[model samples]
Structures are given as structure tokens and as C-alpha cells.
Target: MAWWAWLLVQSVVWCSAGVVAVLWWLWVTKPHVDIPGPPTLPIIGNALDFLEHPVTVNKIRDFHRQYGDLLRFYAGPKLVVLAAHPDDIQHVMVTSKIVERDPLTTSAMRSFVGDGLLTLNGSRWKTHRKLINPTFHSELHGNFLEAFHEGSLYLSELLATDSAGGAAPADVHAAAFSSAMRSFCIASIGVDPDRLIPDISKHEVSAVMRRIIVLMQTMMVRPWRRSLSLLRLSSEGRAILMYYAHLRKSVDEVIALRSAATEEGPAKMRRRLLETLVKPGGQTAIPLSEVQDELMTMAVTATDTTAMLMSYTLALLALHPDWQDAARRELKDVFGEGGDYLRSPSLAELASLRVLESIIKETLRLFPVVPMLPRILTEDIRLSGGRVLVPKGTILYVAPFLTHRLPQFFPDPLKFDPSRFLEGRSGEEHPCSYLPFGLGSRNCVGSQYARLEIKVFLATVLRRFRFLPHSRWEDLENSVLSITLHTFKPIEVYCVPLQESGL
Candidate 1:
């Protein structure tokens, strides 16, 4: 009605228009660096995708089918690019700029294991890598063969005691973890856990490992809980801190014992990796904290991982009796029917078991324990295949699970056939296709050790027992991703003692 009133209303309308215009400009032209990915809600991005599909392997696999090799999505506000193609994986892992681990993954891992080689980056990573590299050399693993033999014997006895008589099914994974942990203690810390640290059994370590798994799965699936403040408020998070404290204490005890032995006796008396790390010759001395971090990293990666692989391979063999019999025959050929295999076999003899190696390789292809290896690009990466733009600060995940199953790399990838790994077939495939131990400079350090442990444990167990599947293969297909891929329950198998099987 009044001229002044009209002017006031016009001012308010113009202010609102200016605000909307600025917002629109920011929304449309902010930055178009995002790669192809699933649809996202405003602000939330693709965080819900993890919640809907908790199993990250299947989620990445399904996304690859829908979005092709390279796809970008947000974990909370952070952008992550999933590189599924073998070429892209190779490029990211081997050729990418400043191939450091994603901050989220590194932070989470560090929270559990401290700043070990697995979590370190740049100069620190390089220094530690050089220091720790010699400890896992092929020659060093040979000294630990007796440990493997003893651990495998303990596992067999444990199974025998559990099954007692009459084809009773036992948890193969349980046995595998027990043996693997002891072997790790023996090889890494130079201590027989059963004799020195009776209480630090797989049962205890697994309880801690399970909690760590829950903490990781929770943080991954629920982006809201990924924050340090939020995680500290949760029970699983608190349990993780407590577990780490306990782990540090136990590791310290082992280190102290090793140190005393090394100090009191000649250097020749000490052969374990811990001795080398504790009293490194001609290398920079590693800090106790750093040693603990590396030890924890090895304990988690080498022990349960190799154990799980052994269990999965055995389960697969159980499901396919032909392969089981074939592997057993190969074992017999190499070890000569319980001659030295039960006590100790040299690395050369172990490597001679080609069929068993093939089976393990195939199992790793199908059920890669560390299914998704993640790296963060410090700068923009134009992928090799499609020249996909993975922007700087972008987290790239190399999904071996998806790439391993691609028909291009692996024919009939679902089929549990070890023949594909029998030399010529797998050698013909892309090198990046099989990355159960990851790729590039930052690939798993204990890979050689892991392979040796698997071969030794498998040969020992298969020699003494015949594993029969307790569940259908289809049921076993469902796996939970927690740093490593694992079945929801312990994989059960009928452990028929070789004498009873009459093979």
C-alpha cells in the first residue's frame, strides 16, 4: 500500500534471489572431478551402499558389473574410487603417484596395530620396509621349518582329540588358527607359545581378532562411526584399545625373552625374525614400539590369513574328493608317506609339492583373504585402460576379488579347479588378476612366509587326515569381509584320520 513498504519487500526478495543464485553457482560449477559411480543422496553420497551391502567384495563386484572398472563414491564426505579392472589395478598399485594407503584404512589399522609397515607411508614406510624386509627372506623362513612341523603336529593332535573316532566333523578353521598362531610365535618371536606363553592361545588371540573385525566392519559399514570421537564411545572400540594394550604386553614378554636369549647367548643361537629386528646387524635399530607394531601386523596378517587360506583350501578339497586325493598323492610323492613331513621338511621338498601349491593358489584366487587392497592417490591419476580420471586425494581400492573372478582373467572363475593354476594357465593371465597378497612395492611382506606356512600345514594335515565337507559349497559362498574375508561360522569338515580312511 505504501511506497516504503514496497521498497522493503523488494529488498528482501532481491536478497533471497542473490542467495539462491550463489548456491546454484556453487552446486553446478564447484568441481566436476567425481568419476562414474552409483547414485548418491545429497551430502550422504554412497555411504548407504555399504550399509545395504555389508560385504564389500560383493558390493564392489556388483558395482563393477554396473559401472565398469572405475567408479567413484563417497565414504562419508571422502571420495573413494574403486578400480576393478586388472590393468587399472596394476596402474594404481604399481604406477600411481605417491601410492600411500587411504587415510581411513591406515588410521583404522594403526588404531589396532600402531604405525607398523602396513600403516606407514612415504619415508617412514621406506625405512621400515628396508629394515623389516630381510627378516622375511626365503633363507630365513627355512630356519622356521621345525616350528611349522611342530605347529602342524599340534594341529593334527588337536583334531584327532576333537574327532576322537568315527568320522566326526570338526572345525577346520579353528584348528588352522591354533596352529597358525603358534607357528607365527615360533617363527616370528622365536618362542613356542604353548611352552612359554600357555595362556596366549588362538582362543584368546581370536577373541581379540574377532573384536577388531567387528570394529573395522562397523566403521566401514557405518560411516558415522568412523570418526575417532564416535568410535571411542562404542563398546567394540573400547575393546580394541584394551586388546591392543594386552597385545603389547604379550609381545613385550616375547621380545624380552628373545632379547635375553640373544644377549646371553651367541648370535648363532637366535634364528627367529624377532632377533633380527631386536638386534639388527648393520641396520638402523628399530624402536620397541615400532617393533611391536610390525609384530602385531605380522601376527594379524601372517597367522590368521594363512590359516584361513588353509581352511578354505581344505574345505574346497573336501567338496571335491578328486582334488583332495590328488593333493594327498602329491604330498605322498614329495614327503614319502610320513617320512620327514611329520617332523620337518626342507623348503626345497615343500616347494616340490606342486599340486598342493596349485590348489592353494586357486583357493586364494577365489577367496582372497584381503579381498580389497586400498591406496590413496596423492595426485590425479589417468588410468591406463580408459584414461579414467581418479582425482587427487581420491581413495582407490584395488578389488582383487572382482578382478580374480572376471572371465577375461579367469575362465569359469566360480569353478573350484586347481588346474587353472598349474603353471601355463595362470602364467598366461594378467599378473594383477591374482593379488591375494596384493601388488607393487607395498605388497604383503610376509607373502613368502605365508606360502611356506600354507604348504607345510596343508601337507602335514592332508597326510594324516582326509577332509570331507560338512556344508554345501553354496552355503560357504557367503563370506564376511573384515580386513580378511571369512565365513560367518567356523568351516566344519569331517577329519577322518588317514589310517581310518584306508585311502
Candidate 2:
């Protein structure tokens, strides 16, 4: 053979050898877990499964039913293990070695949130968490009551206007999202939306946020699109970048306005979370870039998750009028039957809302806004009483959606029984089983704030209007697990004035 032909043959042989060597290495180091899941396709693994069914709650349930509590699958070449059993979840959640979130998901999130708490790992996350913790303290919650009340009132008015005095049905999610966004702006960012961006409406802001979140979710599940340079070349990626820029510009305006206001002296500054983060005393001052990222993270998480929680709770209450009546009775007892139903509940009064709280808890149990918590293993770990070995560098998904539905943890898990949470019933369950706000050191820090906001909104809405079932109320079960949980269609309900209902 000629020299050129010999050289080509040699290159082909070397390339083949290299590919075989890599395959051998992967096979030798792959996770030894004996868990069963849907058969994976070569290179792609079970990625097509996710692509076919992007909203994976039902599929996950099917897998848990077919396979046992612990199941293994893959996203592209990444080895993924889903831990549905409380024991396995506990092992993953509490283990110090499993501190890092899945890098692929984190990389996707970083485009929107930068190095904020949601995407950050290690000491940086620890520091930011410590600094932000005091802002959500119960003592400080009272400071946000005015904003929450105002937002609640705004929602009531919006609903009233949209429904034309109870003659029409309103999209509960949209209204709740608007209300939550308005409240988040005032309470967390210390800027009034009306004053800061007079040109922008709550609906506009909410729509932009929803688009951004949808884009982020898309990037998360489709790992191949995570490359920023490549993603920016696509239309969907460009739209997301535009949406993120729009959001960041708004937040940057707030930061600039708040920073200038801070110069006027401490007396002029209200005790808003942005103020605390911008000028966190005696600690390392958070960088401006980090502050922006943190605010963005707070904006998406606080508003979207809280809105979904409120929507789901209201929808469930509408389906179950007895529970609604029971919640109203509790509200009546706290605020009085003849008093102002629109009045804002004080922190103590909000705390007194046990029945309402139970209903909210049950709603979360049924539909956790963040269904799956993804983490990457830093060290090899044995689960299932040492029967299965999940190798280091493997991706682990501690699925609260699946774990919360386990028959062992929650009896008849599909049923929406608010009473299950009342009287300390939830305390009897495994610690890792109920993870609506997540568990362990890295759990959501804004959980208390979220609960407070949801309570205020629910109390205000329930007091003003009774939620009547809409034609699509049963569709709440059909949810899409985006960055946050969303239904296949917007959740709609008829809001009847309490006066008309003669409650």
C-alpha cells in the first residue's frame, strides 16, 4: 500500500483503540447499584424517556411502582439514581459529602441566577446562607405584613375586576403570581413596583418571569443545550437571554435605587432584605454581582413557588368545600365573624391559622413546587443497608414527589386530606419524607417567608371570596415540573363574593 493509505489506516486504528479504552474505563467505574429502571439506550441512556415525557411526576411514580424504592437511570451519559425511600433519601440528604448540587443542573441555573444560593456550592453558599438567614427570621416577618396585606388586597381587587363581580372565572395562578411578585418586590427588595417601574404592570413582570423559568427548566432537562456559547446561537436560548436581561435590568434598577437610598442614612432605610444583603454588617460585604444574583434567585424562588403554593391550596379548597368551610371557621375565630375580612392578620394571628396551615401543608404534600432535588455524589456511598453502592461522581436525585407518595411514609398519599397534617400527624412521619421546602443544611432558606406570604394571601382571598370549582379544577393533578411546578393548563376558579354567598 502507498504511504498515505498506510497513515490513514494507522489513524483509524488509534482512534478505535482510544474509544474502546474510554468505554472500558466507564464500565469499570460505573455505579454498582443493583436498582432497576427503564432500559437505557447507548450513549443517550434514558434521555429520550425524559424528552418524551418532560413532566416526569407520573413517569417517576410508574418507575417507583415497577422498580423498588431506589431506581437507577441516566440522563445522556450521566448515571442518575433516584432515591424514593426515606432511608435512602436520608442517607443522601444528610451526608456531608453530598453537598454539591448536580453540576449540569447548576450550570443551567447559573445563566439566570449567577453564583446565587440556588447554584452555589461550598463555603460561598454557607456564607451567603448565614448572611441571609436573619432576614427571614420570624421576628422580621412582621415587617413584611404591610406589603403582604397590600399584595393580598391587590389580588382581591384584580380577581374582582377580572371576574366582573363573580360572573366570570379568573386564572388563579396569574393573579397569585402578580400578587406574590408585588409583595416580593416590596418586602424583599424594598422597592415599590409602582414607583420603581411605573411603566411595567404586574402581569407583564409575571409573564416575563414565567418565560425565564420555562427556559431555565428546558436547559436543565436537555443537558446537550447547556453550553452557553452554543445555546446563545439558538432562538429559544436567545429568547431566554433576552428575558433574563429584562429581569436583571429591573432588579439592577431596584438595587441602584436602594443603594442610593441607603446613603441617606440608616434611619431612612426600612428593614428590607435587600438592605440587609447590601449592607450586611461585621461580615464580608457581598459583591455587587453576587447581590444581583442573590436578588434574582430570591425573586424567582419566592414569587413562583409561593404563587404555585397559593394556587394549589385554593384549588384544593375549592374541590373540598367542607375543608374550605372549616378553614373559614378558623379564620372567623381568629379575626371574628363580623370583623373586617380584608384586614391583614398580624404575625400572631397568622400563626393562629392552624386549619389553614394544615390545608396548605397538605397541598404542598400533594404537589411540591420543586418535585426533585438533584445532587451529585462526591464520595462513594452504600445505601439499602449496604446492598447497593452508588459510586462517587454519580448523580443522585432525592425525589420528594415520589418519597412523599410512598405508602410507608404517607398513607393513601394521593388523597388530599388536610387533617393528616393537623394534630402533629406529620411529626410522626420520617424527617426526610416531608420535603416541600427540602431538608438538610442546604434546604430553602426562604421557607418561613414563603409560608408567611402564602398564609397572608390565602387568608385575605378566602375571607373576601369563596373559591368555587372551575371546569378545569381537576386538572391540578396534571402538572408540569418546570423549575417550579406548573399545571398543564392554567388553574382557573370562580371567585364568588362572600356577601353573595352569605357566608
Candidate 3:
């Protein structure tokens, strides 16, 4: 109604618009280091590109090619620096003491893995590293071999039966593979893997395994897409929580079994960790619950991972019969057709056969069971190339995917050539390269156990039946959940009996 009132209102509106304009300029000029990249969007960043091919390893490789070694990429709203050089990776691993596995990851993975070594950090982690290091000592290798032998033999028998019956092929359950491998590891610590499984039958176990795998699959699919109406509902979100409950209950049972077992036989002997867990500070007082959680952790991380890897390796071998044939021939030459190189072969005897070891190395290169290592920086740290300054809270990721396939390191990187690992050489011609199980202090502690399990499974199966893929190479594709790279199909193959070698 009045001229003065109208002018006052107009002044307020103009001030608000001016503030918004200045904020936009600051947002537009946010510094991004020049490492090549395909165009990135304003707010969402590379979230869509990541979800587009999270299951396949190719997406990560493309980032390496387009962005160069130390490029910046965003997942959801978080900025992550992907490291390509081993030196830069080790720098990140060693320099920052406070880096941790992503908090959201630990919370979600605790759905299945629990608070195992895979997720633990800082002082607790150091205590764990100090305690378990001795378990893998050279002398103790014999004690672990018995469990590895028995479990591997059981796996061997399983494949043999499938070959004999000529049943429809199997999809290779991720949890079952993980659980079974962990059973072997658990048994070495005096707990039976199967008995630890709560009286469940093979059929029931497989069903439970499938459920857990599906829960993780759902997480990957619904990732940044959780804003969608369906996923936001009470029913869909509630289902994920239920899966976690069952997983926790099952792991808790196994942990109890490990806790109850006493120190009598070699299997029952507790390493340094047991002393800290069961008998703290020479008091001889046992905190049985931590022991239980530690046992669960090992099982949760170790079992599914090794199984996924073995499954992937088998699928890859089926796809490439030439390598499969070569591996089989090598096995026959050394073990003399089902002679059990696994049970009684001395380290010297095993080492004499260089070819067998080479194949294992190559399998690791192509299908590194765990493709990515994720950490959050606690402090600002400089990498080898001054261009990359890793700041606190920046989630750092190092992928075996890019390093394993780099053309500079391994010639014609995608091709499966076992000879590249001949004579204990780096599969990659590139230095600080080829980290299938990672390196330095933070390397996969179960590397030895994984190698033994995979070798035994491959050796025994190939001896019995030659696996030939049913579909074309193009049909083979990987479907990943969390960390493991795996096939979505049954990995169908014909198991032709070897006439000369009696298996």
C-alpha cells in the first residue's frame, strides 16, 4: 500500500539473490587436479558410472586409463583417490596410521563378517597382527596341513561325486565356499567346521548360503539407488536386517565352539592371540567372548573369499581349456595321477614342480579374489607423485584390477598366460606390481591357507574330470557383491573321465 514498504521488500529479495550468485562461483571453481577423466557432473560426481559396472572389473580399469595413475573419483558424495603405483599404495598404507576400513562398510559387513580382523583397526589391529603372526610359522605349517588336507580331500570328493553322477551344474554358493574354507581354518584351531555349523545338512546350508549372498547382492543394487520408493519401504529394509540376525546367530555359535575347546592337542594350542584373548596379561583369565568374535571374523572373511576365488578360477579354467589342459598335464607329471601331492608332498617336492606354482600365480593375477582395498585417511599425506595429497577422511582405494591388467607390466594383460609367473618373477614387468593378496604389513594373513586350498581343489578335480565350458567366452560375466568377483551362471562343463590316470 505504501511506496516505502514496497522498496524495503525489493531490497531483501535482491540481497538473497546476490548471496546465491557468489556461492555458485565458489562451487564452480573447486580445484580438481589434472589427471585425465571423462566428464563428471556437478553434484552426483561419478556415482552413476560406478554403479553402471560395479560387478565387472572393467569400470575400475577404465578409470585408470582415463584418469591416469592418481585420479580423483567420487562414489556417492565422497571423494576417493585411486592409486595405481605400488609405491604410492604402500606409501598410503604405511604413512597414515589412522586410516580405517570405511565405517559404513564395517556396519554393513558386520551384517555377515562381524568384527573380524578384516574390519578391526588401530591398537586392537596391532594386537591382532602381533598375536596371529606366529600361527603361520614354518614349523606350524605341518599342523595346519592336516586340516588343509582333510578339508581339501572333502572338497575333492565333492567334485568327484558331481562328476560321476552327471548332475546339473552348480552355481557355486559364495557363503558355502567361504564357510567351508573357514571350517578348515577353524578345525586347525580345534573346532570342527561342519559341527560348528549347528547340525545343518548340506541342503539346508546351501539354502542359508544363498540367502546371505542375495542380501549382499541387494545392497550393491540398491546402493545410491536407496532413495527409490521401493527400497525405502519398511518391508524391503527390514529383510536386510533379518539376514544380519541369522548371520550373527550362526557365527556366534561357531565362536562358542572355538571358545569351549581347551589346550590339549596341537590343534587346541593357542598362539599369542589366545593368550591375550583367553588369558589376559599372564593372569590366566579368559575372556571367551573376544575369542569367539575373532574366530567368527576369520571364518566370515576367509571362507567366502577363498571359495569365490576357487569358483572363479574353475570358471576361468573351463572357459580356457588350453590352460586347463596345461595345468592338468603338469599335475599328472608331478603327482602321477591322483597320487595326493596335497597330503604328503614335502615343500621340496612341491617346489620342484615349477609349472604347478606358475598356474596358481596366474590365477591370482587375473581373478584376485579380493579386488579392492579401502581405507580412510586420518591425516594429510603426500604420495610419491606430489600431485596427489591424501587428506583426512578421504576414502582411499587401491584396486588389484588395474595393476594386474596394466599392459606395461604384463604384456597383452588380458590373456591368461601362466608362464608370466615362471621362476618366482613378478607377473607384471612393472615394479611394485602384482598384489593379488596385497603387500607389506597389511597383506592378507590367510594367503598361505588360500593357496593350499585352491591348489588341492584344482589338482584333485582336474585329475578326475576335464571341465569344458558349455557356453561361448562372451557369455562368461562376473557378478560381484562386496569384494568377490564371480560368475552368475552354473559354470557348466562336461567332466570327461581320464582313462589312463585312475581318479
Candidate 4:
């Protein structure tokens, strides 16, 4: 053979040998776990499952049914374990070493939210959490209560206007988002959204946010586009960056206005969360960029989650009038009957809303805003009493949605029963079984604020309007899992004035 032909043959042989050697190394080094899962395709593994099915919640539930409590699947070479058992979930959440969020899931989030509380990990997360914790104290809730009440009143007015005084169905989710965003703005930054951003409407900002979240979720399923550098190369990635820039600009403008106001005097800073956050002199002073990130985090995380909770709660209540009446009676008892229904409930009065709280809990159990919590295991952990081992470097998904539906944890989990959460009935449930806000030390920091905001809105709105069933309720089961859970269609409800409904 000629010299060139011999060289070509040698190169082909060497390349084939290298590929075989790498494959052998990967096979030998792969972590071993005694877990059963669905059959996977080589290289791609089970990624086609997500790509083929748009509804992730349903697909995850199907996997749970097929593989039992602890199931494993590969997301394009990444080993992902879905832990539905409470003990396993608790172990994963409480372990200090396992505090890091899954890089694949959070990479897109970081671009949108920066390194805020939701995406931060390690000592930086700890420091930020420590600084932000005091802002949500019970005492400060009173300040937030005013914003909540105002937002709720605005929500009622919007619903009333949209429903044509009970003649038409109203978009509950849109109204809830508006209300939640308003309350978040006032409480977090001490400014009304309308006044702060005069040119852009809240609806426009919401649309931008929704688009950004959908793009981020798209990046999550396609592992190839997981990193920012790789994502920027695609059209979707560029769109996310553009949308996020708009969002960040709006938030920064609000922060700048709030910061300027804070500079005026200490008196002006009262009851403002931004004031507390922006002020210097802590043991570890936070940078301005960190403040902007935290505020943006609050805007993205708090508003939508609370709005979804409110929408789901109202939808469920509309379907079950008896529960609605029961909730109203509780509200009547606290605020007194035939009085001003629009009046804001005090901190003590808000706390007195047990029936409303139960309804909220049940709604969350049924439709958790954040259905799946993703983490990456740093060390080898044995679960199920050491009978099963999940090796280090594996991706872990502590699915509250799956855990909440487990027959062992919640009886007849599909049923919408608010009474299941009333005091004594919930005593038998595991601590980690019902984590609507999440579990462990790294759980949502604004959980208390969210609960309080929802209660205030529900109390105000339920008092003014009686929710009736709408045609859109049939689409409730069709939810899309983005950064947060969202109904495939807008959740609509018939709003009848309390007097007209003869309540």
C-alpha cells in the first residue's frame, strides 16, 4: 500500500481504540445503585420522555407509578433519582453537604435572578439568608398587611369589573397576579407598581416574566442548552437574555427609586424591606448588585407562587360551595357579619383564620406551585434503612408533588378535602410529606409572607364575592410545569356579589 493509505488506516484504528477505551472507563466508573427504573436509550437515556411529553407533572407521576417510591432515570447521561419517600427526602434535604441545587436546573434561573437566595448556595446563601430573614419577621408582617389588603381590594375591583357584576366569567389568575405583584411591590420596595413603572403596565411585565420562565424551562429539558454560553448560541437563549434584561431594568429602576427615598431620612425608611436590605453596616455587608438580585428574586418567586396559590384555592372553593360557606363563616366570626367586608384584617385577625389556612394548605397539597425540588448529591447516601444506596454525584429530585400524593402519606390524595389539614387530623402526617413551601434549611425564605399575603387576599375577596363554577374549571388538571406550576389555560371563575348570591 502507498504511505498515505497506510497512515489513514492507522489513524482510523487509533480513533476506534480511543473511543472503546473511554466507553470501558465510563462503564467501570459508573455508580452502582440497586434501583429499578424504566428502560433507557444509550447516550440520550430518558430525555426523549421529557421531549415527547410537554406535561412534566403527569410524566413524573407515571414514572412514580411504574417504578415505585424511589425511581432512577437518566437525563442525557445524568443520573436523576426521584425520591418519593419521606425518609429519603428528609435525609437529602437535611444533609449539610447536599445543599447545592442541581446545576442543570438552576443555570437558567441564575441568568434571570442572579445569585439571589433562590439560586445561591454554600456560605454566600447562608449570609444572604441571615440578612434577609429579619425582614420577614412577625412584627414586619403588620407593615405588609396594609399592602396585602390594598392588593386584595384591587383584586376584588378587577374581578368585579371583568366579570361584569357576575354576568361573565373572570380570569382569576390574571387578577391574582396583579394583586400579588402589587402587594409584592409595595411591601418589598415601598412603591406602587403603577406609580413606580408609569410607562409599563404590570400585565406587560408579567408577560415578559412568563416568557422568560418558559424559556428557562425549555433550557432545563434540553441538556445541550443548559449552560449560559451554550444557550446564548441559540435563539431561545438570546430571547431569555433579552427578556431578563427588561425584567432586571424594571427592578433596578424600582430599587433606585427606593434607594433614593431611603437616603432622605430614617423616617422614610420605615416599613420598607428595601430600606433594611440596602442599608450598610452588617458583619458581612451585601453589595448593591446582591440587593438588586434579592429584590428581583422576590419579584419573580414571591408574586407568581402566591398568585397561583390564590387561583387554585379559589377554583377549588368554587367547585365546593360548602367549603366556601364554611370559610366565609370563619371570616364572619373573625371580622363580624354585615360589617365592611373590604376591611383589612389585622395581624392577630389574619392568624385567627384557621379555616382559610386549611383551605390554602389543601389547595397547595393538590397543586403545589413548585412541584419538584432538585438537588445534586455531594456524598454517597444510603436510604431505606441502608437497603438502597444513591451514589454521590447523582442528581436528586425531592418531589413534593409525588410525596404528597403517596397513599401512605395522604389518604385518597386526589380528593379535594380541606378538613384533612384541620389541627388534629394532620398530626399523623410526616413532617416532610406535605412541603408546599418546601422542606429543611434551604426551603423558601418568604413562605410566611406568602401565607400571610394569601390569607389577606382570600379573606378580602371571599367576603366581597362568592366564587361559582366556571367552564374553565374542567381544564384544572392540565397544568404545565415551568419554573413554577401553571395551568395550561387561565383559571377562570364566576364571581357573584355576596348580596346577589344571597350569602
- Local distance difference test scores for all models: 0.73, 0.78, 0.59, 0.77
Q: Please give the RMSD of candidate 2 to the true structure.
A: 3.4
* Model 1 Cα lDDT, one tens digit per residue, 378-491: 877788464556677777778877777888778878999899977657534776777888877888888888888888888888878878778667645667766787776667
Please identify which of the two predictions, 2 or 4, would achieve the higher TM-score against the true structure: 2
Clashing residue pairs, backbone N/CA/C < 3 A, model 4: none
Q: TM-score per candidate, in order?
A: 0.86, 0.89, 0.78, 0.88
* Candidate that scores best on TM-score: 2
Per-candidate alpha-carbon RMSD to the true structure = 5.5, 3.4, 5.8, 3.6
Off-target runs (Cα >4 Å) in candidate 4 are 1-28, 95-97, 198-208, 226-243, 259-264, 267-271, 280-284, 426-428, 471-474, 500-502
Better of 2 and 3 by lDDT: 2
- The list of candidate 1 runs beyond 4 A from truth reads 1-34, 195-208, 221-243, 259-271, 280-284, 337-343, 384-386, 426-428, 500-502
* True-vs-predicted CA distance for residue 379, candidate 4, Å: 1.4
Q: State the TM-score for model 4.
A: 0.88
What range of 10 consecutive residues in model 4 has the weakest lDDT sum?
262-271
* Model 3 / residue 62 / CA error / Å: 3.3
* lDDT per residue as tens, model 3, 229-252: 343366545454454355557655
